[model samples]
Target chain A: MRSFLSSRWGKLAIGVVLVGFAAMLPLLNIHIPGVLPGPTYTPGALSVLAYAMLIAALALSYHLIFGVAGMLSFGHAMFFAAGAYGLGILLNLLAPSGMPPEAVFLVAIVLTLVVALVLGNLVGALALRVTGISFAMVTLAFAQAANVMIRRNTGDLTGGEEGVRLEASLVPEALVGVVNTRNLYWLALGILVLVYLACVWIERSRLGHVVAAARENELRVTVLGLRPYTVRLFVFGAAAVLAAVAGIGFMLLQSSATPRISTADFTLTLLVIVVLGGVGYRWGAIVGGIVYTILDQRLAELASSSWIAELPPVLHIPLSEPLFILGMLFVLVVMFAPGGIVGISHRLTKGRGGKKDAAEPAVLQDLEA
Target chain B: MSTVLLLLITGVGLGALYFLVASGLSLIYGLMGVLNFAHGSFLTLSGFLGWEVGRRVGDGTWLGLVVGMLVGLVAGALVAAITELVFIRRLYNRHIEQVLVTVGLGLASVALFEGIWGSDPIQISVPGWLRETTEILGSHIPNDRWLLIGAAVVVLALIVLFLQRTSYGLVIRAGVENRTMVTALGIDVRRAFTIVFAIGGAAAGLGGVLASVYFGTVSAHQGTSLLIYAFIVTVIGGLGSLSGAAIASVLVAVIQQFANYYWGIGDLAIVLALAVVVLVRPTGLMGKVKH
Candidate 1:
């Protein structure tokens, strides 16, 4: 069974089953008391799931840069924001241009993609010049600059502190109102699948091999006459574009693009998601994103619950802050479970006499190197 | 001309604050290779606690302010040292994990602070004289600017002295140059790591109180906002270089002031300057370390 599961057809069969199950989730009447706010068929549950899928998509993109390519970036949120705010502002701008709604929507998305592509290339080109912590700092500085611009509402385009809302008139009927939430959920699911497949393709491609090898030993890659810089830049750009795609989904689902999306904190959250899912595993990003979103939402509810408020101040204060809990969880994961959820699961399987894979925790390997 | 003077002095004053935070960050990164994300949390916590103590002692008085500054300094050092000992020590030799730990601490601590202090910026009373402006060469410079500048200069001098004159400083210098060589010399370098964290925390703590004076209030987020600029300064000055941090702090702050006044693009200008410096000379202006 294990050998068959490791085979290509078995993996494909599992993938089909999982995707089909996820697609049928909204039609199911399942109710998870602590996890989902309502039954799966309800708009609330669907919206929450949609948001999770969108975040999962974003995390997958981040996984490409940090997990796959071993580039730790603190500015990834800027690309996501570009896609969200870009599509938002463009829709608002082009709404009154006398074009059909479909044409306007298509043009806005294309423009957003172009903007994200340009931004990705520009930032990647400049930031890739340096390596390690300096690279992280450079990305951070640029992101901060972008955040400042978004907050300052340069040219009054970003709507500043209030953020930009999607022009309902410009959006297609299938993705606009609360009644169309299931459609949006389907859209989000589609995006997650698309992003996941893209990540898989990228990871399988020759470029992915070169990038991974460079992460392990840049000197060795250099010796082989490969410029690690160009390949790294390419992966970075690809990740940025993918992040933008997730951002577009986010804007559509939420119907608004806020300055909050552009923050360094948001990028940090993505980093946490990537690490939590198990840094080097693509599936880890997806799992981490889903788990984090649900936990974040549930924790907020738990914080405001009557039982929590009745507790002592010490317990009350810590529990009331979801981020605080998540942050501590992230720290614990880094310290105790370096491979994150995937690592722990792998260990459990190995202990159960499952097929032993030779892969160690990538983060641990990074440390040993 | 008077305006230029005001901007220059004020810019220098702000730079002094950056140096306070960046100095510790530079040393810690230089010697330990940890970026110390929690450095800002140290500042924030110290600022809150120092303000808490100072108000109980006496608010709106010079003595109160002085006492607060000292409290902030001690608080910063204590928390930083504890962080290095407890969280950082366990992750020893694992640079990425150490950074992740700090990042987690930074996020968690900020949230906890918001819970305890409330998210709003709390106004703190300063001495009456500190609220007044002093005339300097026909320009009315805020008196607090002088205090900030004075405190930062003393900090820079003291740190320089410590690094050059102390045995621990010698170990740190050697460690920054090459940790393996330092370890090979049979020196217990872990103690030096704790010392660097402590020193960095102290400066950030002092900067915290002064930052309150500069901004007229302390918010849960003040440290984080300031830390970003400090990071830019640390990078432009070249990480691990005290002198580099000092020079870059002033240069970045002055440019920020000038750009903000002239074109309302202070933050963008600083980022641009950082980019130019990084691209042109990745080692930074005064960076001697290869990293």
Candidate 2:
């Protein structure tokens, strides 16, 4: 624990205070004084915050594998879906309604973790066998096939194209009760904070350094007389479990898990979040998640109904198709801001270029087009 | 005996579609050295355009079929050029970015396809003569299936011939082996790469049109699905190896048919086979050992 908070004590302290504020957000308000009538702390905002926090937590777990371990996986949705459906099935089949919600959640989480262990180890073992582009493509095939399998034939187990509704008894009442909004917010924010700190510790640990080195050059690690695969596989398995836990938070917040859970688009969403913030950086995932969710949600509203919809075609660019805008954003970020928002700021803080950051792969400048 | 013959034809016919799509994918990967995640987008888009042209001229006419296919081929080639010039050409070595940008392009294109065509799978028809069935052994088989088989054989041969006989083909083969050496030789390797990409697009367009007619409908999501099969074939065949892709596609198709016939597993068998292949041969079944 001391080592976990060893050097980042001040930052950790501030983060805890901020979480406290978030937990008490319903009682707090932000006033613009002249134009605004009240604090924007509405019930809707709580749900959005909870959702964003869960997503950000999930994104952080992805950062552990992709950013830290340099393993690009397209099958993360598999883990997410498994965690969600695992909980739903446990509640529906094994647990009685008379069981305590807390006990049910604990059992469900344990079950989900077991599933994650088996899956994470299996996938890590398989995925670690390939490197670079083939790695991404192979994982993609696995996930896509899984998506097809679960959606059409396994309706009895998965609810098929229509997802199974999570039982009310599965989630702790404090997390889902009508009047327990504050408690839900506290739990979500708390989990987000814990997951964030845990990821930060992972990044700072010796294993984290080893994973980073392996990510940069597996051959180098081999030359150094260390096995890169074993180190990366360990990270992969742990990160998969964390991601599964985040999925449980997502299910608890939404009160249901749909077949949409397994879609590649969801994994893409996580990818966009990680890239939008910055890969490998500690805090980028959370920032990226909040920014992405708000942008996605608001852009849709502005395009369809808000006064922003009445704007000229020029301004309505992203607001038009929205997905076109998101796609374009991804391209532009990758092209110009390869380090994303965090890396850009980090670079600006230093001198120009700053030795190109070892974590960054071959730059787009090689294109020379 | 008839059942066996039917399965064989079925497997071969399926393999031909996989060949048409995967061959282009292999060529693109071979010559360009970039994974075109949007290859299926071209397939889907071209198939839809072809179907539209065919529908206007009435079903199953030679003129309509030719016009439709031509439309698909031209559009596919154009898209490939634009895709290369606008995006891919600029991001050569940064593969993760390549995956993201191409995936984004593919997704946005799928949305555009859905917007234009709606979610409905558009019905397409083959020419009357092509639709007729002939008895082979004891089972009746569609004449178009034979046409598909013949087309596959011809395409494969033409590809080999072009590579072996044409100066452009030699340049491509050399470029695949060593891009730098080929460029140093004053071959304008990038231009060669562009042509190869356009050819890939054209081939995928051909596959798209054939798939539309063969499957009798074209859906927006088929691009991603077909792309997966193409990826599977290309990967298993050894990326950029024409012969490898050809052999692997047929093997995968036979496996798919067997699994579906016996266990009703359909595509799952392909995924499982791929998993097994990756475990045993990480580079793929026919993939050249990389240094």
Candidate 3:
């Protein structure tokens, strides 16, 4: 029974349920039969769903490094930004002609992967030398360096502070039109599903066990006659590429790459998402992503909307800033709900017959043993 | 020769700021194994506060410098106390939770500064004596670097003296080596932590005042950037080693100055320092080898 619950089918079943709900969210505005009104859908809601998916995909990639491998990086933004700006640079350089949007995307992705591969190898090599807090700080330092280089040196390619706009003509008509954003919505959804499955597979794999072992104690892993550095190097490179893949989706969703993508604040946002969802939980990424997007959208609305804007100065000082509110939420959630919503639910179901196997992530369970 | 000398002075001066930033961080790590991610926010907050104080004391007297430093230290100490008492003390063994909390606080503080300061950079002017240039090796350079270097060294020396010469310092050193033993000795470890945090805060505030004065401007958002530098220096200096921080700061600054001179890119120098320190000497130059 336990084996079956941990099997591929079980995970896939979970995925299907989630995807179904996600797909249905924007299509299910209705009246509950003679009782009450149901969810109201909007294109705006669809777009937000799309964004949440991208954030989930990105957060999952971070989980592989931070949660699975125990490497807390303060600069995951570098890879995300790399993936994003890599495409923008390529499209701009190869302008006025393209075989097709598909071809351009493929070629650009290939280039970005190569860039991700090299940068990942370099950063991972340096970063892997230090462990714990030092490693986190080093990643941040490199990230800042990357941000500066992108902002100052690549003015022609990146548009400096002004930010570079991806030329729309670079992609095919069906894939990207200013008004018709359904293509992006579909693209983000499909890619998010695929990447999510990849994350699940990683969590259940032997390599995942090895990564988990390394996270717990490298010296112990070494005594067991396994090469920990090779494991760290491989996971780091894969995580970097995975983050870049999400970055590609991000650029496509926005149809442009900006300096904002590379900021440390963005990485902090990703960290908050993972921590707030469920640090090691496979599906926590999606849950956290949605929660973050909704809170972000609502708070930002409250801060900028007419009522708050018109409030008196003394009364208006504290509550109107969306970022301040988000920051407070981050602190509250991490402090109060460290296990995230998933963990909270698990606690609530303590009295009932709980799905124990599903609750414990495979990697974490192995590490514990 | 003069250019090299001047560059060396500037590097040392730049490094002094790094030292100040890393002092509180290193001390915190030494006594308690927590890395304050919001250390730079303390610096930023203090810088803005110090700038306002300096502005108020527009007489350009030594009193202005004294007031600015005092204001920065007090504000930084207050904020640090709140953070330690209200937030950090609760999560003692959980380093990862502390990271997230501090990072959140870091962002919140930056946003708060933005709300108050309105995204504009504030300019700072030092006393005339501090700003006056002097001829050194036939090169004319402002005395601001000297003041920065002087102030940083003095603060670091005072901290070393306090730790070495005082009972509290002895307790902190003992605590760093083994907290259990320190706790067994009945030295309320938590209160000691608060004191350390306050000291760290004051040091960060001092860094803010010195940094803004050296750069001639302070921005609400500079904390995030400065935090990166301080973290790197602390890591490369080997966690909890004050001397390591000072040396690493100078090494980082000199490399940056040289990198700028040759490649017209200074940030790359710091990146290179990180790479070298990580790959070649992960324990840092002065750091003892440890697991």
Candidate 4:
């Protein structure tokens, strides 16, 4: 049984089952109190689920850069904004150019991907010049610049602080409106699966090994005639492009893109999600994304609940703030729970064997090098 | 020509604000190698409390403003020192974890601030003199610009004096150069870390008060927005050098002001400048570390 579970066919079968189960969730009447607002089949729950999946996909891409490449980037949200805004603007711009709605949708996706690709390369090429903290800082500067540009609404492109909405005329019919929430949910799921598979393929490839090695020790990789810079740049760009893909899904699911998506705080929240889930594990990101979304939503509800409203100021204030709770949870996780949720689970289920695999992400310390 | 004069002085005034925040960042990163994301929270908290105390003391009076500045300074130092002692000290030698802790603190503190003060920017009352304009070279510059510049100059002088004159400053300078060597000398370096945190926090706090005066409002997110520019300045100035920060602050702010005035690309210009600097000299203009 153990061998079967580890076999390629077995793993593929498990993945199929998991995806099938998730896909059927919106069609079922299952309820998870405190986590879901209503039954699973409801539009509200489906919307939340879809949002979580997109976030998970984004976090997975971040894992490729941070977990796999050991790059501490505080600016990953720019590419996300790029994907979201890119699609939003492209759809609105092209909708009036005598293109059919279907054609416009297809063309807009392609253009947004293209824009994201170019942006990823441009940012990677420049930011890759410096290593470690400087790299992080440079990326941050670029993201901040992008944020300012969006907020300024120059030429009336970004809609300033108001942000741009998804052009309803341009999007496909099946992906629009509350009644079609399940379609959007499936789209987000597809994106998550696609991003996850891409991340797996990259990790299992020779380039991934090289990138991982460079993370471990750059000098050793350099001694092997490998250009760690090029490899890292490729990973960074790929991650950025993937983040953009998630952004597109995000735009579709929400039916609008906001300036808030472009902010540094958004990127920090992504960081929080990744760390909360687990640093190096792929499933961790997915789980972290879903869990964080649910907690965030539910906590907001809980804050406004009647019983909690009666609490004293000290208890009431901290409990009422979702981000404060999440942030404190994150700090505690970093300090005590090194491997995050995945690590804890591994330790609980597998005992001695899991202990070795569950060690704290050594990449965290190596970031200084 | 008058426009040029106005932009130049205004740029310097803005640069002074940037320097106030960047100076401590430089010192802390130089000595401790930790990028304190919570530094912005310190500024935000101090800004709120400073305004609170200032209003209660004498609202719109110079006396209130002075008291507010003092409260900001103490609040900053105390909060920073406590953070170092409680959270950062526990994660010694773990740079990434230290940073993550700060990130978490930054997020939590901002939320807490919002909880306390609400999310909106509170209009602050300042002395009437601050609202007036001074004519310099036929250019009308806001009176607050002089206050900002003067306060920043005094801060820079005091920090320089402290670094050069005090024994702790001597240790801090040496520690920045080679922390291991200082540790090998049997000196207690953790104390230095706390001191640096306090000093950095104090500067940021002072900046928070001045920032309220400049913007005429205090908001939970004000520190965060300004923190980004300060981060830019800190990087351009070469992470650990005081003089580098001072020079880069003025240079970046002036360039930003000019670009904003001429082409409306101030933030982009600053970003481009950072990119150019990193490409040309990755260590920064006066950066000591070879990154």
Please report how far candidate 1 places residue A107 from its true position, in Å: 1.4
The reply for model 3, stretches above 4 Å from the true place, is A1-11, A24-43, A96-102, A309-315, A357-369, B59-61, B129-131, B184-186, B289-291
In order, the candidates keep a fraction of the true contacts of 0.75, 0.42, 0.61, 0.78
Q: Provide the overall lDDT of each model, using Cα atoms, as 2-decimal numbers.
A: 0.92, 0.77, 0.79, 0.91
Q: Estimate, for each residue in A168-246, the C-alpha lDDT of model 4 and write its tens digit.
A: 8778889889999999999999999999999999999999999999998999999999999999999999999999999
| Candidate 3 lDDT tens digits, B1-291 | 888887888888888888888889988887777789889899999988888887788645678878888899999999998899999888776777777889889877788777778778876667887777799878777788888788888888888898899988888877877788889978888887998999999989988888888878889877767777788888888887878888888888888887888787888778877777788887777775231
Model 2 chain B: weakest 10-residue lDDT segment is B282-291
TM-scores across all candidates? 0.99, 0.90, 0.91, 0.98
**Residue-level error in angstroms, candidate 4, position B235:** 0.7
Best TM-score among the predictions, by candidate number: 1
Q: What tens-digit string does per-residue lDDT give for candidate 2 at A91-165?
A: 786566566777777877898889987888888788778876677667777787778777864647777777767
| Preferred candidate (lDDT higher): 1 or 4 | 1
For residue A45, model 2's alpha carbon misses the true position, in angstroms, by 2.4
- Candidate 4 regions exceeding 4 Å error are A2-10, A352-355
Residue range with the least summed lDDT across 10 consecutive positions in model 2 chain A? A360-369
Question: Which residues of candidate 2, in runs, are more than 4 Å off?
Answer: A1-10, A30-40, A96-101, A153-155, A177-181, A306-319, A347-369, B125-133, B289-291
TM-score of 4: 0.98
Question: For candidate 4, what is the lDDT?
Answer: 0.91
TM-score-superior candidate, 1 or 4:
1
Query: Which digits, one per residue and each the tens of the lDDT, describe model 2 over residues B1-291?
Result: 887777778788889989988888888777665778788888998999888887797667888887888888888888887887788777865556776778778866776676567778876677887777788898877777776677789889988999899999999988877777888878788777778878788878878888887888899877777788878887788887888889998889888888889888878889888888888887776676242
